[model samples]
Target: MASCAQKLLEIIYNRRSIRKYHRKPIPDDVLKAILEAGRQAPSARNLQPYCFIIVRDQELKKRLIFSEWNRFIEEAPVVIVGCGDSRAKWAVVDVAIALQNMVIAAEALGLGTCWIGHFIEEEVKKLLRIPEHIKVVAMITLGYPAEKPGPRPKKSLEELIRYETYE
Candidate 1:
């Protein structure tokens, strides 16, 4: 059997932005585990000024559509809206880390996730009744993937990394 670290690396490497999903619902316990992963993420000063809006209602999912590229938002079984407090100094960064945690956890559990960054802030706030003091950091769609997509192109270590300093 592979070590825990090796398993984690495999999960991270295989994860993709899944756009197609099975029409099945996620179990409550599974969903809770995914959310718990996000909740356990570290935050700046441990303030953890982040909240997630779990959207499961079909109508609400349809209403969240804001662009042609993200039409798959309505197809996923769950859409998690990551929000952060405006007054927090590192709200955006904290929320992003938390959401990424959830993504990793979901992938580990044989689920898929897609980060949706395009949306009208005001429309989302109006539709979800988000507070004025809170800002939407990003949204992620989660479900059982219907397709297994190969890895996309990426920069090699030689091109992306620099030894010690930029020389």
Candidate 2:
């Protein structure tokens, strides 16, 4: 068995925002595991003010693709709608942490996930039938990858990090 650290590193390195997916449905167990990870994520002050809607209907996914950076929603078997409860002040931060957990969990389970951003407040609420008190922060397309994406280029640590303060 791989050590926990090894598993974590694999998840961090292998996970990518996969934009294409095979036309195959994800098994129930895997989807459950992914959702479980999101549920276990830490929230600001543990407010846990997020709700997830698992969308599988082809038509709904099609309608969702209109959101920016979310074209893949039209093809993936499942798209997770991350919603935040506006009644709670820390809803946005809580939802973001939960989404990251879901992405990492998908990678660990040999699944690919792509995060769709561009939070058009009104449009998403209507699409998912979200109540006025809930805010839609992001969407994620989940499935087996149809095409393998090469590692995305990144800035070196020195370029991204500062030892003490900005000079």
Provide backbone clash counts, one per model. 0, 0
Q: Model-by-model lDDT, in order?
A: 0.96, 0.87
Screening candidate 1 with a backbone cut-off below 3 angstroms (N, C-alpha, C), the clashing residue pairs are none
Poorest stretch of ten by lDDT in candidate 2: 64-73
- Model 2 segments beyond 4 Å from truth? 67-69
Q: Write the per-residue lDDT of candidate 1 for residues 32-100, one digit (tens) a residue.
A: 999999999999999999899999999999988898988898889999999999899999999999999
TM-score of each: 0.96, 0.91
- Residue 161, model 2: lDDT of 94
Specify the highest-TM-score model's number: 1
lDDT of 2 by residue, 18-102 (tens): 9889988999999999999999999878889999999999988888766556677788999999999988888988998999999
